[model samples]
Target: MQTAASKAPAFRAASMALPVGILTLITLMVLPIPAVMLDVFFVLNIALSVAVLMAAMNAMKPLDFSSFPSVLLFATLLRLALNVASTRVVLVSGHEGAGAAGDVIESFGQFLVGGNFAVGIFVFVILLIINMIVITKGAGRVSEVSARFTLDALPGKQMAIDSDIAAGLMTSDEAKARRAEVATEADFYGAMDGASKFVKGDAIAALLILAVNIIAGFCLGMISHGLTAAEAAESYITLAVGDALVAQVPALLLSIAAAVIVTRVTDKSDLAGHIGGQFSDPRSWMPVAVVMGALGMIPAMPQSVFLPAAAIAGYLAWHLKKRAAQPEPVAEAPPVSPDRITMEDVSDRTLITIEMGYGLVHLVDKAKGAPLVARITGVRRQLSQTFGFIVPQFRVRDSLDIDANAYRVLLGGVHIGGATIRNARVLAIDIGDVREGHAIEGEPTFDPSFGCPALWIEESERDHATAEGFLTVDPSTVIATHLDQLLSRRPDALLGPEEVRALLDTVKEDSPGLIEAIHPDPLSLSKLTRVLRALLADGISLAHPLPVLSSLALALQQTQDFEALIDRVRIDMGGWIVGKICPYGEVLPVVTLDARLESAILQGMRDPATGQPIIEPDLAGMIGERLARISADLAQRDTPANTPALVVQPPARRALNALVRARAPDCVVMALAELPTSQAVEVIAVIGAEEEQAEPQNARQEELAA
Candidate 1:
């Protein structure tokens, strides 16, 4: 058992480590210290500097020694404080001898400088120059540059982390840790940049203190003690030089430590390990061994030194060569029994995947600050909001089988779409009306998202391309835009039963009673999913969940037929539909069917048996062709290819919508009953006429006979 007496010293030492150390430094600066106490403090200063150097050398990375800057500050202060204490002791007692200041200083003066005051002065100045001019200056410069670059690259690093998180490659906890490490690295380098100034100032202060002590000691010695001028000079200058050397040596050690740390890369291994591994190759040693051996044989050279050095290099070269020649041992795999194979061996396929060729792999490389990952995250977020469900995480991977510049978007292991992108070039998409001559010379291709013509130009030509009225985008944006378009077109395929339940659970919070009133009775969750999928299939948004839920609940109570229920819900969602098609205070651009064609379509939908319209092939074919033509014309007139509304009577709306969806899916087919009264209509084009249907009818009959 430990007694109180045994633990008291350890406890006191632990408790006094910071506060007492600071107080002692303050006391040493303020009051004169005796030679013996000064000697002890000087020794402590040297030991602290050595400890700092060893710690710096052993650190695996800069962040591992994050407190180094503060440690450097404290060490510099301790040395300066010791300088003051020793300066006072030396100036007051230098009339006696070189040993007047302290044993540490006295020994440095007599033993290190051989008791010559001039030699001590010369050595002190040399150490001061090395610390102030070379090591400290270089370290300070490295710290400044590191801090600036770290701060400049902070945003890119943070973006990379967020992209990794969005890509599901990093967990939230891992991202948080990485962000903290980045912040610590920036702070450490910034502190070092400031802390380096302390070392420089300490060196200058040592010089000033030495000069003061020597000059003051000489005057006091001659005036008060009645000593000769030469004797006074010798005694005072010797102690002063010793004091300067004692302080400067530790300053030099710390300066070296600072340089080592600031210049160190964030490698996994320590300095020694890194150096040993780098120099391990026999090829590198062989050249040095040969050069040393040749030098050892030269006439008039110091063979005693050179031969041994050559011999050591030769031995290192031979040892390294033999080690390189040895075969690497491989571990044997454990035996597997066929009967023990399980389903766990098979990997499940991802719902969505973006596979790129080798050349385009940099678009997902975190080190390169790839913007594609972040852009894809934004696309997913926007699609989720528009489609009323969370899009699955996209898996980005590389494939060697694809073309070097090509990337494929895969949905459920099937290739949906792909595009070729130049990693070092920007795609300038022409938005119509760009003259051929004005555009720069480059590889011309169609934009993958919409098939608009685009030019692949060097990054430096981006400004010129933009000035020529082309929209400039990087490879990442091009891929993300293409993916967005593909996802937008296939919203129905993305929504499943899980997304349906999520939607219900989300809306239940706002109207819990309403959600409870309509489930499993009038409408099952499966039926609701189908209805929602139908709405999303036609470019409708489900952002307003409460309204959608309320509409669904109201419609389900009146009809058991899923088709009729969806139509009622669409009618109930007129305000939202109208708002999406036509902005507030703007008239809706609509295409109306010719009177005769409208009547035929109504007659076709009069079947009471299946609730599905079965039109004649000729009439259906004619209507599809006319609608597609009208949609194309309207798209050309609109700036961004706005969806043209095909207005019809409420009875024929469902039949007409089905007809148009099969042909021109981009057109919006709205019923007269579904149009919001607040919005006005502008008839832009007419869809069909009697004469237009006649030719298709005759051709269809001929084809059938054939």
Candidate 2:
């Protein structure tokens, strides 16, 4: 069963059809075929042409027949090759009789024109005219125009799909499908423009082949076969005309098929149904009936034919009019009740929402280009790349309850931050370098993102503010930066089990064994989510989950105690966490608790439920205050580290983390076990040591070196 399933698609009919068809077409052009085989091919050619025509008519839209161009190419080749084959036999066998080529051609030559060579010539010329001058030419022109217009509109169609995605009206999968469809439509029309040339050239080839057959057969019959003018004309001319007609009929059918394909307007119904539906309208047939009846009354017109057509038209109009007069079944207007409440009405599905007042609505409006919305989209994309998962879509909506110029960011229905904006005004933030009382006239305010002193300046004063050593930004940038500042610190608040599951599914595709070792076995989803959240709060990003999970998987081999599991993962990942802040080829500027101070904090208080250490209130306050001051000093002085990290024993890292983050959030906390020995450190500050208990300056230097 398994072998059969694996081998099924290896031997498909479509896989062999193209090669077999091409070989047959080549054989017809080069090799001589018997009359029986020639008859079979002729019937097949007629059948194939009719199939193409029916396929074109049945297509509901142009894209549904996207393969028409290639199909037309193959069909045109087959017919021309058949022409080459039939021409070979006719010139060689014309002196024998009408039956020399095959019955298909013999019947066409003898029966189609009643064995009259002149009538067959006239009939063949008429088909050439219709196929070349009418159908092929018109279809080519339509294809060229369609290709030009489609190429012109390509950029706009792509932009519209992107806009829908940014506006949150379409999902990623839906956008991909829409983009593929637009590209396919363009390619199809361009191919048709080229393919129409094949049909036109085929028609010309048919006419030239006919002329060659008649002239060559005439000369050969009289000179070589000892036949007279009347006998030669009867034998050769009839066969030449018959061969032309046989190929011409299919060529005409294909020309009509190409025209049908190019001219079709996209509709819900196929060609037959669309045309029938349009004629079913009573108003259109009423005019038709009147015109037919008027023509039938004229004596010069054929009364027998025109009168019945007029009567048939009248009956169609009357029947359509009666159907139109019958009232459609009414649905009783659905009882005019109040709209029933659904879960979507009251519950907010959006994980993050930007609710603004009426005045700030223009910031998110689509017609004005939605500057704020675009920025928000960029922020979402950047964060998703940073965090290695798609951040949920943010919803921007207007509310009457807030101040007209204010907009607020929400996470899971909880207010994160709200700030007021001065519409049309730019905020020039003072980055602590502006000289005292430099004269720049504007309204004074604090920059909402970081509380830096800023001025809401008019657009004209932008250069003046820049000259005064202030960084300038528009209203949209202010909101986006503020949102980034607030959200970048709270990644765990944004991550959930759904996001973790998505990450797991992604990693499973690349490294399945790593996931199977840790997930749904030692750690269920709920437990795994808790562990990841703790890692995120401890300053580890899931952006590169492979390394993080790789460390976790190794740790699971030792122990599954929840707290022990977290600590082991952190210790394994510590060198990475510290490398992010400290510039390369320089010592990491470190702060640590004095050995005695850490001992006191470790032994002070414990949570009764979890048995984890809690910090003494007074000591926690002193540590936060000292770390905050050291962080400020580090910012001004030259240092390898961007921020000071508090390194303590493993037991006290979490308690000190909450404490240091409260006052100086930029400062990172790490355990002594977490830091790698290869990374040299400079002990810049040490918390809680007396003049006597503290180690000497030289001793402290040696302590950091060790």
lDDT (10s digit) by residue, model 2, range 308-346: 888888899899999989999887666544678778779
Query: Which lDDT tens digits does candidate 1 get at residues 589-637?
Result: 7766766777776676456785655677787788788778877777777
Worst 10 residues of 1 by lDDT: 697-706
TM accuracy, model 2: 0.54
- At residue 78, what lDDT does model 1 achieve? 94
Model 2: how far residue 547 lies from native, Å: 1.0
Q: Would you give me the overall lDDT of model 1?
A: 0.84
Q: lDDT scores for all predictions?
A: 0.84, 0.88
- Cα RMSD to native, each candidate? 18.7, 18.1
Model 2 RMSD in angstroms: 18.1
